[model samples]
Target: MICKHRRYLMYISQNYSYAILRPIQKYILSQGGEVCWFLEGDEVDSSYLLTQETKLKTVKEVVDWKPDAVFVPGNTVPRFIPGVKVAVFHGFDSGKRSSKRGHFNIRGCFDLYCTQGPATTKPFQYLATKYGYFDVVETGWPTLDPLFEDNASNPYVDDNDKRPVILMCSTFSQSLSCAPTLFNKVKELSEKGRWRWLVQFHPKMPLEIVEKYKSLQNDNLQFIETDNVLPLLQMADVMLCDTSSVLIMFLLLGKPVVSFRNQSPSSYLIDVVDPSKIEGSIEKALTKPLEIESAINDYSKQVHPYQDGKSSARVVVATNELIENGLTNKRRKPLNLIRNFKLRKALKYWGC
Candidate 1:
């Protein structure tokens, strides 16, 4: 399909959006399309913008550029922006919260939702039918393209160290996070120098907890703070996580995940209640037992079956299709006056 989306805008509000949108940007550039970024809010660092990348300093600049579509990794986008708003999503549904507040929450700011897989697509499709405003397309997730790409080098991988790498990730939510609970056990295990531990927490994780983990870094363990967690995910033999959606990302690699008190544990995860059992669970995951491996494969298929590094292409195509067809058949998006007003106040764009 010939993509008419020659000019696209990346709407970023958080640091993680950079990793999610960069692959899509790469695909657009290769297709001879132009992509510019419009960074909003304080959470997103302007320094993350590459020298080669173009940034529209103000909402006026974005309006003047007239992008065909605006790709948003966050929940909401400015509807006033002149483009078809596409929700690419920030992360998989980790089931940490109810559908009303979590991943399935529709704020009516998007024209289309490019879902990751069947698991998400079905629900979004149902919502589309019910709401009659936004369209749903299963284009996988562009953020994971690097994870599936061949010939990709992992800088974290050490040739000399043959020990299995365990990536530990946690959500930032005070109620759902396991970082605090597992800190003591992790510290004990890292000191043992049996397995290499890589600890990464959500950007919004509390400073005190993050510091505690950072202090535990030694020859056996490392605390990584990066925009891209793909390398760590690739290098790790097994993942140790809680309710963080990152475990879903790790599971897509067909690796085992040992979640600590997961909100909703299934056959896919070896869920442990006590911190003391973390090591045993890790060992079990490393073994890649037939039952758990089969479950992981099944869950991976439901969440993200696409192992090919071409989800970006599909996203571009989906956006182009939406732009060309228009939303004439669907009902208009809700006014969303309050949210839009807040966004306008934030961006200082009062233009009608």
Candidate 2:
């Protein structure tokens, strides 16, 4: 008889996973579970950045394949496994005190909830706790597995580089606040010798936004967007990011990250949560973001708490446990919708 423990479905509908997901998904399958890709075909195709007809067509063909347990990128969708559905908060949620984002409400419907690592358990717990009633679990997010598998020598520096290299990542929308904040950080740091700034815009952001930065013409500045240029993250010593969840992978590299307390889609006030200061905070951090050496020494003790980097393994284990418990409980039933069909249904009804 087939082993019941070997049941999982890993789903990512966005382009963020094409490179990173392949190995992790393979590893999940190797561990006696199933992992697959199901792309959502971006909601809008204004530019042809998403046009890989061959690859898109391939994913569309296999979209219906299912598993006993499912994993989705965020609170956006629940991968409908025959037995369960799950929503994963795969990064440091930017739900600061000022901006209360209820995007995670989708978690109420999922059978399980997962986060990046132990460093995140408390912050995420707060989100679930605030609501008073919600079903949430703390399986470490799987995206960090690559760090464990990396046999490379330690690359993190003890002090800021002579010319600290900064990577600024902007989300598709609502980046106006983030851009100025990040630019201020970059401009402040660039005066130091050889300081380089590489700004990567989200694929869906406006071209005018990209053009504004490009015109700066600082010898140390370069602006790029959702291209095949994956090396930028690897080269960045510090990553300044908006609330985009993709920052998890950058942090996994042990690089320091400065997050902008993103404002509401309509609100005009810009607030910095973690640092609680404006450009001056960037001044202090560019000089000592995460206190490079201290963050390294106390990483296991304070921040990560569970820094084994086997987060993917934990996700698989927890998901399996959830499936087992769900099988025992009569109230919990599997989420039985197909991948694309869920998106279509959401668009037709919820219009998101």
Each candidate structure's TM-score, on Cα atoms with residue i matched to residue i, is 0.98, 0.63
| lDDT string, candidate 2, 1-352, tens digits | 2223454544555554444344345556566555444455463232423342223233333334445655666455533224465565434444422323553443344665665445556655675555433345565555544444543443332255456677778765553347754554455555443556777776666777677777764666767654332466667776777666445456545655666775422111122554336445445555654355354445433323445656566666666666655522334333434644675565343321
Model 1 scores a TM of 0.98
RMSD of 1: 1.2
Residue range with the least summed lDDT across 10 consecutive positions in model 2: 262-271
Give the distance in Å from residue 195's predicted Cα in candidate 1 to where it truly belongs: 0.7
**Per-model lDDT:** 0.91, 0.52
Clashes of 2: 2
Model 1, 171-199: lDDT tens digits are 99998899999889999999999999899
Q: Pick the candidate with the highest lDDT.
A: 1
Q: Candidate 1: list runs displaced more than 4 Å.
A: none
Cα lDDT for residue 201, candidate 2:
71
